[model samples]
Target chain A: MILVMGPVDELVTAFFLKHLTDTKREYLFVDERHLGGDVRLELDLPQGPSGKGRLRGAVHFPTWRVGLEELTGIYSRLGTGNVEQRKTPEARAEQAHAAALLDLFPGPVANRATAMLSNGSKPCQYAAILAAGLRVPDTLVGGTWERWEPFARALDGDPVIKSVSDERSLVKQVSWEATRASARPGQALAPHQFQQRIHGTNIRAHVVGARHVLACRAETQALDYRHPDMTGHTVSLRATELPEPVAEACRRLSRALGVDLAGIDLIEPPGGSSRPEDWVCLEVNTCPGFMWFEQNAGLPIARVLADFLGTPLGS
Target chain B: MSNQSTDAGLISSQDLPKLAEAGHVAAPTVGNSAAELREAVQAALAEQWSLMGIIDTGKKASDLGKKAADALTDKGKEIEDKAIHREKDARDEAHRKMNDDKAKKHGREAGAHGATTNAFARALSELRG
Candidate 1:
């Protein structure tokens, strides 16, 4: 049996569940909203060798229960809803315990909780991206106007500003003068991500099971294709193929990050060759809402994701 | 040179209403002012378009709008319902015209989805931290 954890109504979770059901897979739906209420969890992991420990647990629903040992794999979207904002102590403990199980469960968790931590720090991911042989745009995490002046000067133009961490922010191109004019005297600006803006087509590659690579290109004049309205430009998405070397690099990056499934963003520079080094690595999303891609590009992301989750590790 | 490609639909600011029609994104309440309405629309757009990954593990669900699921705050929805009722009862011509203009500007019909709004995208952005 497979375990799907999240709000049943969330788009991505719902999409995955639909596919899993249509495929006739035996899976347990653990609704995060119902946790501590309609759903309960009991886990027992006695002390043992680091890798030899066995996680024994059972998830109890109103009318049924399933043992952790019976779970062949796990696909979790628990963070997709307000479950994390539990007010009651009981609710908090329940969520924490479930998260622990997701972290320690020795199976193909779409992404282990630990692997997902790489997304918390963009710079850290950049190091991994570079080591994976992908080009990382010049990025500055935090600095005052004086500190940033030289870095911005080295760029093609005013650098693009964005959120440093996983927090989502609009990617905006601002000139050095605009930044200095807005900065207060002698005070360090709040930590922000400023990176060299690469002129290219935006490509999102979904790497599944470190082998299946489905990619699409987003054609938009907007600095951030995600919010085309902000730039008054329409966005078109179409399925595309990644160059073999770049596709292989994405696979390596996913394996290195320990994310069984990853949404890897890249920028293919204008007039660039098919070489892996020509594509600029942006960031990897552990829990990608691939429904949008599937709907627009007609990529079989959901079906592939479902297939990946159904197969037990080392099968 | 075009890489291997397939036909995928387009998404843009103009496509906001289409998303509502397709039942993908929730239409927000028509705000009191044009600026507020635009904010609501952009927020809605951001809610639907921005590709945010898993929110912080322990943060509150204050940003549920990002997932584009659930109803807007109950209080806000109630207020929206009351405003619509008042407009209908009073037969306020100017109020109605203003709403129509706002709707046209945003490419969304005013009160399109009744009183309930989708999760507020601004709230979702704030909680993403």
Candidate 2:
């Protein structure tokens, strides 16, 4: 059985529920800790189509002392709390606590809380994906006043700066480059992640099995597609298989992070830099928007999930 | 003092030390009790929400709010894990079944898959084994 741990925002929860049913799967969602433990396992032990099914049981542990006899797999989807609602001190503490708990799971955890963090933050994710021999963009993460100023000054006004770790985490998500951006040397009030923005469409790689890479490109407003003002681009989902090395890297990254799967986001920078060595692996999403990506990418992710858990997906 | 209580004029952060000095504050509702403060803050926020929106989530409780606040303080990485588990269960399941079957059919391939994709392929191979 698999367990879901976050508050399960209404929209995200509804999407998963729909997919769970569509894929002929059932889940035990846990947001609060019960008397014994705070965990939820999506049990499917009932003897049904697979014949190998057993007497099912689902339980979540605030700790991982419990057994894993009927266990099959696990998923981590929790994220930092909403930002705008929180205050300064509360926000910092909350994010730090979230990071710690991310590091603190019961047993058989995926997505290392430590591995998930980086000095470069999201840029580090891209670097890791690249180092794993995957296709990634020619990205850059700079905070040095001298080093980044040169790059920023020369670039077309719209480069994307992903704040390392908890920078814009709480505020409106720092998804893309600012619409009205201004850059002055030393104007960086806080440390920031400045990557030479990719000018291609988004490719959301829903990496499950080793070679099982469901790659799909999403449309957005401008070059850095995730920008808030991106409404002109109409999303058209299609499944594009990643090359062997890139696919292999997707698998390797999941392994390195201790997660069996991830939603690896990438970009095909404008030029023919589409080669394996040229593509930029943006970030690895531990808890990606399954419904949104599926809708945009048109991958049979729900079905894939249902099959994984021995239930029916998109059922 | 909690944020809500402070907002309600029940007790101010400055008054907290005085209240403690007067031996009026409880263990779970004071300066060191960050959780209690958070609850009060949440309640205060909720009250604001009540005024801004319709205030439908029921009135916040001092005790419950404190508990939530305390949990919030201590809930570090668990938040991310919760997010993943909550959203990815369905997909993870389907992934398990297909990969597990792949394990039975293609051991070496599954091994490579696991090596490449972590336990995803490894678990599939385990099922096969």
DockQ top scorer: 1
- All candidates: TM-score: 0.71, 0.51
| Candidate 1 per-residue lDDT over residues B16-122, each given as its tens digit | 22221212334333344323433443443344333221122111242243233326567666665564465334433433443343334222311232221124322
What DockQ does every candidate get? Answer: 0.03, 0.02
lDDT per model, in order?
Answer: 0.67, 0.44
The per-prediction CA RMSD against the true structure, in angstroms, equals 16.1, 17.9
* lDDT, candidate 2, A122-159, per-residue tens: 65565567667665433445445456556666666545
Candidate 1 residue spans exceeding 4 A from truth: A49-53, A82-84, B1-129
Candidate 1 residue pairs in backbone clash? none
Against the true structure, whose TM-score is highest?
A: 1
Error of 2 at A143 (Å): 3.4
